[model samples]
Target chain A: MRQEHKETMKRRRRNIKLTVAYDGTAYHGFQRQNKCVAVQNVLEEILPAVFGDSIEIAAAGRTDAGVHARGQVVNFFSDGMIPIENIPKAANRLLPKDIVVTEAQEADRDFSALHSAKSKIYVYQLYHSKVPDPLLHRYSWQYEYKLCLADMRKALTLVTGEHDFSAFRAAGGALGMNPVRTIYEAECKQEGAMLTFRFWGNGFLYHMVRNIVGTVVKVGNGRLSPDNFAEIMQAKDRNKAGKTAPARGLTLWHVNY
Target chain B: MRQEHKETMKRRRRNIKLTVAYDGTAYHGFQRQNKCVAVQNVLEEILPAVFGDSIEIAAAGRTDAGVHARGQVVNFFSDGMIPIENIPKAANRLLPKDIVVTEAQEADRDFSALHSAKSKIYVYQLYHSKVPDPLLHRYSWQYEYKLCLADMRKALTLVTGEHDFSAFRAAGGALGMNPVRTIYEAECKQEGAMLTFRFWGNGFLYHMVRNIVGTVVKVGNGRLSPDNFAEIMQAKDRNKAGKTAPARGLTLWHVNY
Candidate 1:
């Protein structure tokens, strides 16, 4: 708004960080692909029309297909003088009903959505029921068998803190190929028929959270004990761990910056 | 199967009442129409095909287009011996993703979906926010204006007893043509940005619950006062009430049989 603030960036355009929320049921995922329609593709298709500029963007998470998000972050460079207050409502006007930009803030030119140092949180939801609830079938995994919550909580303790997560990682489009990560918290909460697994971490390897969930579910189901889960983590072998949970049950909750 | 027990009715079919839940966005209301795909048509189209018989069914509430329901009840006479426990899952298999048969039970021929009921409950959900929430926009009413909850609760008290609801009823489809109905319970509950108005009544007329919600919203928004609400009820004129709220915000929550 002021000339001095504009001069601080030296002729470069302003960077905007937007908070996004999406249902993700109708999307291919968060990352833009050539043939498939992703949340990124939807934003790319609509944001340009609103801003009148070709914009390149970066996202906090590249969620797999069928995965949802409530607090995903994105950043883009724009030369237009559109007010930040107008971005979210204007973007929603053109974007599809499933995806929406919730918040828009002008950021320093050097800030990034994926980088700039922060943690992230993800939640995995399960509908514990003898019969599937059609209402929750789209958003939660339906599990019919009995589960030991105490055993699952004990199994959760085995996955936290800094660890070499090679056992949990699955081959995917990860840039650094890093296997070590810092998990700040791992907890399970059950309310009525819905059970949620919350994970707060500095970073996660591909499929790490889901793999941990699968292993913990085995512990809860009595297929594997809590001590066995600790052994599985120590083995550092993907095959030794339980199967990876489905992407539909996982949601990227929030990104810390 | 016990043939003697069933044969006591003498060629009469048993009536089955189904507890149905649906996201009614794609439906043209609950009643069957020749031109559009209604929930009734979908049920009629699928149920007969599943049982190999032409079945006529009736519902407790005929929800409007774009309205949702959690506990809508429908009854159909059937000679088929499909297990009651298997009906819900079996019906869901044939039904579309939006509508689901949640529960089923066999009832005597005297039980009617529309008549042999004590009361019904309805809920209208409102999402209060300055910006639209994409995830909730489908099922909730997005309202950005300021509201006074105390005044709304007071306004709610004026509608919770037996009264001539001519001020609330819209003249359309009526067989008995009675304007008198008894509201058993009426209250407003707020959790964060979502406000839910719960109404339990012996019976409701055409657009009656929605009409009351519209008037309550007017009181909340300060466009109409609580005293004016009482005066409007006494006037017994449809023109004295507020505008009819949109169908998308209303849901058939439950039925007492």
Candidate 2:
């Protein structure tokens, strides 16, 4: 790094961190896309209007379409003089109703929303009912048949700790990316007709959480035993896992720094 | 009643009751309107398709535009041969995604959904936040100011029991209708930033619940005292009450027969 460029960057207020929450049903995804509206596109357009400076942001996770987030981290560099406390308030007013800037703060010059050390917690929601609920359809998957909660619990227990998750990664994932990741916690809890599966992990491959949820649901439905789930994990083949669950059921719950 | 009309009505199967749940954002209201789409319009259209006979339904309440319902009750006389259990399943398949038939059953020959002796429960939802939540804005009213819970509770106590609630009635209410009604239960409960006001009553005059809510909110925000709220009720004039809260925050919770 050039000393002059480093000194220039250090003297200016360059890094701003923001926590965002969004309803992803109207967005294409978290990343910017040329042909479709994305969360990033809206953020980039609104931040400039709020801060009086064009800004580019880096996000912790690029969530897929129809996947909501309650605590998505983002960071950008801006020399504009808006107070950190007012950024979220100002941005929220100008941004579309589907996106919100929940928190904002000044950060160290070199900090990055993407490169920051962190683990994430994701939750997949499901409700078992003979008839679907109109109010909950946007946020949860409605499954008609009764599930074997005991069998699904066993399947989740096998999902904890480090493993090569090749069997769960979707195609078109980054080339040459490592498939091994550590899963700190994987558990399912049911209350009456509603069920929630929460997964906390250091990192996850594309579609890993959804694929695992789909496979665990099959076990709950008695199509496969706990042993079969273990075997699929050991096989380390994407074809061995079940189909990915619908995107509407998934929510990026939080990120732990 | 004529003997032949009575015998023919008694001999045929009739009076099927339905408990419906709907996301009312897409519909103008629960009643059929000439120019705009409504929940009743959709229900009336879809019921005939499912029962193979034209059906006219009577509802317990006529909810206003953008007002939701969790357990709104309706009844229709049908001579069709579809089994009782299959009615909901068949209607659900034919109904729009925003409306659902949650339960259906057989009712007595003389059942009249609107005229049946019954009470009703209504719930109004609110959340206090500096920034509006896009996801919850459709279902809950977002108030930015802090509320005095103690004052709100005091106002709710005064709302119970039978009273001539003309102060809370809106314009265009039924002509010559009795304004006095019995409120069996009236209470407000708060959890964190969320507040829910529930009213169980023999009947509600048009806009009575919403007008009372708006007036009580004034007391909570220090604009009016609890004594002022009681005075408003005593005034027995609509102009003495506060404005009506938005329709989005109100829901027809349930009907008791």
Candidate 3:
């Protein structure tokens, strides 16, 4: 009976799952770094203050600087002193104005945000116009040339499915790690002068999405044919891809896990 | 013939009308203020640099701090050296990143953005949720309440048509000026958890739209019945009205000339 009580007490140490959202314009990235403001640093700073105890958190992905997030997930072990319903309010009061803890849930004690088995959705917005759109400037990239949606669709086909994405990966990216990733969904949706690219993949390299978007834009501009794009993909060379797209236009939209 | 040529040259000193948009989170307001940064100051600083000389300007209405603008119009007189088409690019290069000159056109020299206006449109955004939404923090107000849409719509009816809005005006509103204004269209539009209050009027008193929104929200939450709302409008007393909503939710949506 004593042993059973101890096991129950151990299970009571709750794993708190959080769905977070941030503007990311004023953050270095999602991970904590030296001499920089990160989303993790702020969350770490506030959690201790709100709960009156230090806590460690693990995020699903390390989003780059200036990359927004709507449904980024994180998890941490807690003593379960604060009620689940009040956790969001308590954390938001101490967090920065640009960062918000949108949802909080008590999960199994063994749950881990990083090791969850599923995919992620990232979105990159681009607009074509001579004049900059003030409202969308912080959230979208502005380009001059009008892109052919049909060609962009053709390019998107090359990005989907399982593949060795070394050609689309950036230099200095995750050394010694495999570059194989399966893209579940890749498409460009147009609304007026804006084009939104939505990408859902099992995993991504340091700059995989941005690099793919750049190459697809080249295809839309009539510079690269579908066969040429396939060549760039099979080349297994980083230099074969087009320029890396801007970070401000990218958003970590959702995590399927 | 000399007199006619002089008049033509005088008219050639054309007035440039500009359509402006801005994210007002970082600005004190649309008008110039001491010490604090204002959208007008940024525009004033950039205009001279782009035009190669000082240029005075006027806006349709002075938006409050934390208020955004999508179709705010401004006008200025200048020598037609910088070609009307090139003004947006030149000004945008010098203006702050938050403010944008979206459109520029030559207008009559007698045109004034503050005067010669037919109506103005203002929009207030609100979201109902228990937790904070980081992506919309700068663009909307989050309220924790289950609001009745029918009650909110009924409240909107009490706000339309020409009426003495002394009850809705803020303190120090125009220094004993006429409290009566004509409202052409006023309604509440709901899209999911988002509620948008649109107001079109010949003119608005200081804090008029915000005050109306607060009252409408009160009605939505069942604090004030539709009859109580109508009484507040007819009471012509600021004390009878509900509280003024936050400035972040307000936007100067458009100005019709």
Interface RMSD of each: 2.0, 1.4, 1.2
lDDT of each: 0.86, 0.88, 0.87
Candidate 3: tens digits of C-alpha lDDT, residues A38-147: 99999998897766656778899899999999989998866758889988888888888789888898877767788894999999999877778777888888998867
Clashes of each: 0, 0, 0
**Cα-based lDDT at residue A52, candidate 1:** 84
Q: Candidate 3, B177: how far from true, in Å?
A: 1.3
- CAPRI rating of model 2: medium
Give candidate 1 regions above 4 Å deviation. A1-11, A171-176, B1-11, B171-176
Q: Identify the superior model by DockQ, candidate 1 or candidate 2.
A: 2
Clashing pairs in 2: none
Compared with the true structure, what per-residue lDDT tens digits does model 2 show for residues A125-228? 99888888887888888889768999999999999999999889997788489999999999998888889999999998999999999999999998889999
Among all windows of 10 consecutive residues in model 1 chain B, the one with the lowest summed lDDT is B5-14
Q: On a 0 to 100 scale, what is the lDDT of residue B118 in model 1? A: 90
Task: Give the DockQ (2 decimals) of all models.
Answer: 0.44, 0.62, 0.68
Q: Estimate, for each residue in B14-121, the C-alpha lDDT of model 1 and write its tens digit.
A: 688999988887889999999999999999889976666777788999999988888999987777777788888788889987888888998887888989889999
Kindly state the fnat score of candidate 3: 0.89
Ranking by TM-score: 3, 2, 1
Candidate 3 local lDDT, B1-257, one digit each (tens): 97785455445477889999999989999998889999998898889877775766789999999999999999876674898888888888888778989999888877889998899999999988777677777888889887999999988887889999998999767756899999999998989778999999999999999999998998999999999998888888888788899998999999999
Docking class of 3: medium
Which digits, one per residue and each the tens of the lDDT, describe model 1 over residues A40-145? 9989888888788776678988888888888999988777788989999899889887887889999987888989648999999988887666556667887889
Docking quality (DockQ) of candidate 3? 0.68
